[model samples]
Target: MHDTDDAHSEQESSAIHEPRLWRDKGWTARVIKNEDGDGWAVEMIRDGSAEPALVGPWTMGRNKVDPKPLDATAHQTLVKTASEVIRRHEQQLHAQLNKQCSIETESGSLTVRLVVTPDEFEPFGTLTAVDPFGDVIATVKVPPDFKLTRTRAERWAADGFGRIQ
Candidate 1:
């Protein structure tokens, strides 16, 4: 037998389309009063996220006092823009937390990578050395702010992958 509770929950969470609010396709867009000025603003929040993914100015309607009502095309555009904003934020975060460099040492050529773990109390980074065959030779924990430049990597390799001071 089908679960009535599940069906009721689905109905409760279903799409909602109103003049100033829209909820569909895993996103919710709501028109709000602009905190900075007299005009209005809109905020798009992804499903299950506590904060809005994108917020920006909203246009006024023909009356000039009421904010423009959201439509299908506007919702789609807002979804695209919010998704792009989230994508760019993720890319920038990954770039900031990960770094890589290649260096030729006396032993051989190796690729070094620094992966940072952002812990609340004690953040740290892991330095890993990979051989040409894609095998990890060594890994050492270092400060989260460790700089993994080519010269630094070469020096680390020269030191036989010892713990950096």
Candidate 2:
């Protein structure tokens, strides 16, 4: 009886959680708008997963008009919805957080910051602005660039540019 109960609990637990595999499968998470553009859609990708699963778009609920912007709550909901979709289509995935690089580069006399995130959907990598100085810039999606070297980082700082890369 104990074994049966334990097994039941395991099943119930599995029903709710999915391992993050998008990172390993090279799939990236993207939020798209529904046909109406008033809702959101979550997409999962990989070299080979079952048919594309649709993780219903989050709507503005009852407003029947402009959809709300995705915030932390929306983001968490999307992750759960999308993870469930992937679980139904494939085995547990082993996704990894994208590796990141904060690089400093110079553009003339000014300082520039570059950040990159590597993921499956973006098999190449991403680039973005970290900062010119003194503040956190917008978090953005970027492709990773291995070309960013240490010399470039130091040179950039000396050149008067700082990077969040």
- The candidate maximizing lDDT is 1
Across 40-102, the per-residue lDDT of candidate 2 in tens digits comes to 555544425554454556455356654444444444555566667767644423223233245
Worst 10 residues of 2 by lDDT: 16-25
Please write out the lDDT profile of model 1 over residues 92-146, one tens digit for every residue.
9999999999888777889999999999999999999999999999999999999
TM-score (C-alpha, index-matched) for candidate 1: 0.90
For candidate 1, the lDDT comes to 0.94
Model 1, residue pairs in steric clash:
none
The per-model lDDT (C-alpha) reads 0.94, 0.45
Task: Please give the lDDT score for candidate 2.
Answer: 0.45
TM-scores, one per candidate: 0.90, 0.27
Relative to the true structure, candidate 2 reaches a TM of 0.27
**Where does candidate 2 stray beyond 4 Å?**
1-33, 36-53, 61-63, 92-165
lDDT score at residue 61, model 1, on the 0-100 scale: 98
